[model samples]
Target: MGSVGTRFPTPAVSITKHPATLPRSPIDDDIDKERVAAAVLPQLLDLTAADLTDNAIWRDSLALTGTFRTFFSRELVANTWRHLCKKSTIQELSITAGSAQILRFGPEACWLQASFSFRTQGTFPSVCSGTLGLVPHGYSWKIWLITTILEQPLGFPDVDKLEPGPADTDHPGCLDCIVIGAGLAGLDLAGRLKSMGLSYMVLEKSVEVGDVWSKNRYDSVKMHTSRDYNQLPGLPKTFTKEDYPYYLGSEDLARGFKSYVKTFGINVTTSTRVDAATYDAASKTWTISAEREGTALQMSARHLVLATGSMGTRPVTPSYMNHGKYQGHAMHSICWKNAKPWKGKRGVVIGSANSAHDIIADMVSEGFTSVTLVQRSKTWVLPASTFGALVDPVFNPDTPSEVSDRILLGNPLPIQRLIAMEGIRACADKIPEYFERLEAQGFKTERYGDLWGILCDREGGHFFDVGSGELIAEGKVKVKSNALPLAYTESGLSFEDGTELDADVIVFATGYKGDMKENAKRILGEEVGENLEEFWQCDQEGEIRGAWRDTGHPALWYTGHGYAHARYYSRFLAMRIKADVEGRPIPQWSGSC
Candidate 1:
C-alpha cells in the first residue's frame, strides 16, 4: 500500500515484533553467534533510501540520547527510531569491514560487541569505526547499542578506545596517576585509582580539600542537590537540625569530602598548582611542572586526570562604562565572603541566576536597606519544596544512593527529557501561586524548554527557588527583569532603558568563562592542548560531548560535575585507567567500557 519508490511500512502493531515469525524449537537453544552477526551486520552495512523507512532494519533506539546519558529503555528506543527516521536520510552506506566478538554468554542471553568500518555518502565520507552492542532475541540477535569512534554521536568517543595511560616505558618512580584538583571529582577519582592498587597523587591548588565549599562562600549557601544524592562513595554527608533535610550546607558537604579524605587516606599534595604539562611521545610519559608555596616542583605520571570543574574558575563582573571611575564596592558571586560589611547599604545585584539570587538573599539577610535584582533575560524558577516533591520520590534519602543513580541514569537522554517535560506539563497549572508571585512583583518568568533542558543544555540561566523567589514575590527583594546596565555612576548604575538606580554596592552575579579548552591550554601549553575538544557542552545526541570519556587526546582524561556525576563516573574512569596501565584490552560489552 505504498508508492513505487517508497519503502513498505510494517504494521504499527508489529513495529516491536522480532524479525523471526516463529519461536525457536528449543527455549534453551544456544544462540548461533556467527548466524546472528551475519544476519544483523549486513543490515547495518546496507543503507538504501528505502531502508530508512523499513522498521526491521535499524534499532528502535540508541543507548545514548542526551548530552549526558548512559542507558535507554525499549519504549524510548521505538520513539527515538521514529524521530531519527524523520530527521535523517541515507544516500549511501557501505560496510568496509566488520567482525563480531562474543563478550559473554548465558542460558538466556548473550552479549555481543562488534567493530566495523563503513563509508557514507553525505558529510565527510571517511572511514568510520565503532563498537555495536547486540543481544539475542528470537532465532537471531538484534542490535541494541551503537557507539562510533570516528565521529562520536553528540557526547564522546568509545570508552574502550579512550587513551588514558601513556604507551612508552614506565620509568622508575613514575606515578600511575596524577589527578588535578582536590574537590569532589579529584578526590573521588583518586580514591578509586588507589583502591585499584594504582600509585596516584592528587594536586590541590587550594590549601585544603573542598576549598571551594569551605572558603570564600556566602552566608547560608548549600548544595542544590539533596544530601542523599550528594554523598561521596563511602562516606555520607552529615547534617544538623538547622539544615534542610534534603539539602546539605556548603560547609557540611565540604566536611564530608574532608572526612572521605581522612577515611581513605588519599594522598593529597596541598598548595600545588600544575603550571605546565608536556607529553613526551617517545617516552609516553608526562613531565609536569607545578608550584607549591612558591616552590617549583617536578613530577612524572603515566596518566593525567583533569578534574577541574565546569564552573567559572575566574569570576566575571560586568564591565560598566564607568566601572573604573565609580568607587562603590564591586565583586563577583564567587568572591562574596560576607555581606555583613555592606549592612544598611543600598545594593544592586546584576544577573538573576542561582548565584545571583543566593547573593541577593544574603545581602537582604545581612540587613541591606534595599536590593534590586537586574535580570537581563527570563529565567525558569521552581519552588524548592515543589522541586523536592517532584524529583525526591526517586532521589530521596531512604533508597540506597547507588540504586537511585542507576535507575535514573539507565534511560536514554531523550527519554529522560520527554519524561521531564511531561512532568512539568502536568504540574504547570497547579503551580500558579509560584508564578503569580513573581509576575505580581514585576518579574518576567518563563518555563525552560523540556523540564531539565536548562540544567542539561546550558551552564546557567535558571534558578531553583530555595527562598529567594519567595522574597522577590513578597516584594522583600526588588526585581528589574529584562534590564541592561549601561554604566556605573558614583552612586549606582544607569540602565540602557534610560532608568537609573542608586546603590552603594554592585554585585555582578554574571558568569564565568566556562571554556575547558582554555584551561587545558593554560596547563598543557598550545601544542598539546590545541588537540583537545571543548568540555561540558551538549553534543548532537543530547549528551555532553566531552569530559570523562576518551577525548582524542591520549593519556589525558577529564571528569567533573555534581555529586552524582562524580560518584557514578569515577568508577568507569578508574577502570579505563586500570586497563591502560595493564596493557589489556577493555573487555567487550562490559559496562566499564
Candidate 2:
C-alpha cells in the first residue's frame, strides 16, 4: 500500500473548511417557528418528484435527509429523489395532519422534529412517517435531515406472520456453505450464494433473522450509517429515500431483513447456535456442532463463514471494575432496552464512544437525576450531519452501488485515511464553535490520524456526534475524562483520581473485542482460534487482516462490520467460495503475484 496522501481517484471535490454560518436573526420565535413549519412542507414536496436542480429552498440550503448514515449532499439527494420518483408514483403526501416540535433551541443551530405520512408506488402501498431536522436560517429555516420510517405497512408483506418453524435439526446434512449470524453480512452472502445456485444454510442463534437489531430494543438504537449505504444486495429498494428515508430503528431494520428473507427465499436456520466447528483438509469440509432448544445437532459444510459481525457477540466490561462490591445495577449498553426504571435515578455510564454517548443522552432525556459519562481516553468526534456533506457525496447515487463500493474499498488504506482526515478537518473548520463548546466542557476532542484510521484501521475510537455533543457541552451530561474506575463503592464509582460519584446504575459502553477471537475459540476450538490470524485489524498493506480476504485457514472466511461492506464484498466472497467448490484454480488475491 502507498503512504498517506497518495493521489487517488475520488469523486470528492476540493476541500473547504469554515464554521457553519448562522443567519444574523433568530427563527425560534412563535411566528418564525410556525412560518418555517408552514414553508417546509412545500419545499419537501418539491424535492420528491419535481426537479431539484434549481429548487429555491435547497438551492441556498442543503437538505440533509437520512439518505445514508450521515448527511446526503444536495446533489446526491437530488439524484436519489429522482431515481425513487422514477420508480414509484406518489399516491399521497400528507403534512397538514402532522405536528411539529422543536428539538433544540441553541443559538448556533435549532433542531426541529416533524412527521409526514406518504404513500408511493411499490408492490406495496405503505404509509411512511418521517422526522425532519431543520435549522434556523435568517427569518426561516433550512431543512437538514429527514428520518423516515414505515408507519403502516399496508402493502408490505408480513413474513413473520407466515407459519415456518426453525431449521430441521433432526437430520444431519452436509452442504457447500454454512453462514453464521444472520445479520447484514450473513444475509448478503446468502443472497449472493443463492443467486449462484449454490447450496447453503444460514444459522442464526437468535429467533429472528436480524436478531442483532431485534434483540437490541434500545430506545434510540438505530443504525449509524444511512439506508443507502446499508442496503442488502439484490433487493428492490425497500428503503429508498422516497419511502423509508430515516436511519433505521431496530424494529424496522429487523422487518427489512425478514422481508428480504421472504423475498429471496433465503434458507436460514434460526434459534440454532453453533457450538464447535472442526475442519478436515483432506475433504476440504467442516463438521459443525450446533444447539437449538437444548438439542445438540451435528452438520457439515465445505466452507464456513463467520458472519457474526464485529459487535455481535459479547460486551467487554472492565474486569478491573468491582461489580460485585457495587450495590447498584450494572449492564452493557448493548443490553440496554428501556430507560424506564432509571428515570429519576442517578446513573454513571462508562466510555465516551457512540453507545456511551447515546445511552447518556437517552438517560438525560428520560429525566435521570444525573448521568455522568466516563471517558477513558480522547475520542474523535464528528457531527453526524456532516457525514453526507463531507464523506457520502463522494459516493454519488448516480453511480452503481457496487461500483462505488469497489472504488471506495479498493483504494489504498492510507489514501482512504487521508480523505477521512481531510473530511474531519473540513468539518471541524466548518463548525469550530461546536468543538469550542465541547472543549470548554473539559472534553478534549481530536481526530485520531483520520476517521478511517479509527473506523477501518483500528477497532474503534470515535463518536459520531448527533445531539449528544450538546448534552455534554451544555453540562446536561457530566463528563470525567482520563479517569479509570479503581473500584466500585457501595454508593457509586470511585475513580483513580480519588473522586467518587454517586450512582444508582452503572452502564458500561466500554465496547467489545470485535475481532471475534474468543468466538473463534468457542466455535472453531482453541487450536483454530490460536492459529487464525487476528481479524478486523488492518494489515501493513492497509487491507483488513483476515476478514473477507484470506485467513490462511482452509475453506474458512470471516466478515462483518458495515452494511455496504457486506453488500458489495459478498460478491467477492461468493465468487471465491464458488470457485473453490467448483474445483477451479484459486488465484492470488490483492497482493502482487
Candidate 3:
C-alpha cells in the first residue's frame, strides 16, 4: 500500500511495507431501496423483554459524565446506521459463558449495532464491571492503503483504515497535527484539541473508529475500570433506566467515538496509511508522509500524536513452530470479525491469555463443534462471572458527598489516596472467591507486582489494577505450561509425549510485540540525540503515557495505551499536550526522556 513521507538515507529496521492499496465504491444513498430495519437482537440469549430493558446500574469507573443528548445522538446514529446495513449479515464477535454472544453488524436505524456483554480479562476492579450494548455506523468513508484478503468480505489480515491529520507543506493531507488510531484515545485527544481551536487531523489505520474494540473481536472484551470513570470528556451519555453506568459493547463504543469525531467535525483520514516520517530538528517539525488509493505523497506537521495503543496486533500463527502444519481455518481473533469462517470448524486456540480465552469461549457459543484452549501454561484466569455484574460501593463517584467528604470530590491527593487505599482494602476482605477458585483449579499464581497489589485488587489477576509489581504475592498468576506448543499435522497435533489430538484449526493467541516505525523511532532519537533503541533499555515500559516519550518535544505525544482507562488516559495525555501548546506548564510524569 502506498504511504506518505520520504525515505530515510538508511533506516534502522527493514519494515516490510505495503504500497498503494485498493479502494471500494462509496456507498450510495438508497433510502428508498434501503431502510432501517427493526433489530432482532442475537439469538445467543433467550432474553425476556425485561433483559432488553436498560439495566446500566452500579457506579461508574471514572467520575466524568456526559449529556443525554450526546449518547442519544449515538443511539440515533445507530438508527441511521441500521438504515445503512439492513441487508448486512450479523455476526457475533465474542460470546462468553453466562453472558451474551455479542451480535456484530446488526441492523439499526442509521448504523449497525454490535451488541453484547463483555468482561475484562483477569482484572477484578470493583468499579468497571457490568454488561452493555452499542451501535457503531458502518463504512463512513475509507481510503485504504493497506488490505489483506485472508478473510475478505468479513475482514482482512489487516485493513489499514486511513485518517486525516495536520495540514502539510505540499501534500494537503498532513496538517498542523495528526492523531493516529482513533479509538478511545484518538477521539478524546482530537476532540479536546479541536475544542481549543487547534488545527489538527486524526489518522485512523482502520476503516472506522474504535480500533481497540474493532481490532480485538474476541468475546468478553470490556474496560477494566468502571464505566463512569472511563468516558471520553466530550461525548454524550445514556444512563441506565435505573441510575448507574456500565461498559458498552464494542459497537456501542465505536458509536460513542464516531459521534465525537463527527459532531466535532474532526479531520480524520480513515484508511490512509503512514509509511515513514523524519524529524527535521531544524524546523521543529515532522516531515510526515502517507499513501492513499495508489498515490504517494508527503506533508509536514508541527506535531504527531501516535495514539496507537498498546498491543498492536495478534498473530494467527505462533512465532515458533512446534512441528509441521495442518490447516482448517487457523486465524487470530484479531482476524475473525465474523463467525462465517469458523461456523462449524473445530478449533484449537494456543496460549491461555485473555485473547485466546475470549476467542475459545466465543467460538463455542457460535456453534463451533468443539474448542479447546491449548495452554502452554495456566494463568491467573479470572472468569467474567466474578466481575460480571459486580457492584463496589467504595468508588467515590457513587458515594454521597456527606459520607465521602473525607475521601472524594476535590479532596487533596493524600485524602483521595487514603480513601482509594481504604476502599481497596475493604474489597480485599470482601472478595477472595474469584481467586480461590482459580487456585483450586490448579492455575498456579504469581503475586501481581507485590503484596499491596493483592489487597488493592480486592481479588487477584492480570487485568485487575493495570500495573505489574512484586508487591502482591497472593500467589501471582503463574504460567504453568512453559513447555513448547506441540506440533500439528494434517488432522491433529502431536506432542513429544506422543499425546495427540484432532484439530481443524490452530490459532495462536500469542499477543503482539511493540512496533513503532521510522517516524516513531526518529522522534525517540531526538531525546538521546543518537541511540533510540538504547533509550528503550532505560525505559523498559516502552511508551510512556502510551507513546509519549519524555523527550523535550511537545509535538510528539501519544495517548492510547490499551490499559484500563485507555480512553480517559488518552484524554489525560491530550489535555497535557493541549496545555503545553497553549503556553501552560505541562505536568511531568517522568522527566527523563
Candidates 1 and 3 compared by lDDT, better number: 1
| Each prediction's whole-model lDDT (CA) | 0.61, 0.64, 0.40
lDDT tens digits by residue: candidate 2, 1-593: 00112221112211122111222223444644444565675665456423222211111001111111121344555555544444444456555443676643123334554655566555333455454446655544666554443333343232112222232334336788999889888988888777665678999988877767877557767766667777677636445666564567787788889978887678898999898898876777788999998999888998899988775456788865666787888888777886788899998988887788778878988899888888888778877767777646545444456545644553334433554555556556767787889888878787433566566645566787767889989999888886778888888888888889899988888777665656777887676566665566554334455667655576777878788766766766775676567776233312110
lDDT of 1 by residue, 1-593 (tens): 00111111111121112231111122223545445555565654432332222212221112221123332333433444344323332223333243555542112223554554443223222233444556555545555554433222212222222112232233257888899888888877876676566778889988888777878577667766566667665433323234535567677867776767776667788889889987776676878899999999999988888887766577777677987767788778777776788899988888877888778888888899999999888777766765676677876656655556543443334434544554555565567777887988878887433444554556667777777888898898898875688898878888888988988888888887775667778998775566666666544334555566655565787888667767666766776676667765232221211
Using all chains and alpha carbons, the TM-scores for the candidates as numbered come to 0.71, 0.68, 0.54
Residue 590 in candidate 3, Cα distance off native in Å: 8.3
**Highest TM-score model number:** 1
Clashing pairs in 2: 18-430, 19-430, 64-144, 68-226, 69-225, 69-226, 71-388, 148-246
**Candidate 3 lDDT tens digits, 463-506:** 34221111112323222243455566667676656666666776
- Model 2 has an lDDT value of 0.64
- Model 2 root-mean-square deviation: 14.7
By lDDT, highest first, what's the ranking? 2, 1, 3
Cα RMSD (angstroms) for every candidate in the order listed: 13.3, 14.7, 22.4
lDDT of 3 at 420: 37
**Residue pairs in collision within model 1:** 60-77, 61-77, 66-542, 66-543, 67-542, 67-543, 67-544, 68-543, 68-544
lDDT of 1 at 37: 51
Candidate 2: worst-modelled 10 consecutive residues by lDDT: 59-68
**Residue 210 in model 3: shift from native, Å?**
3.6
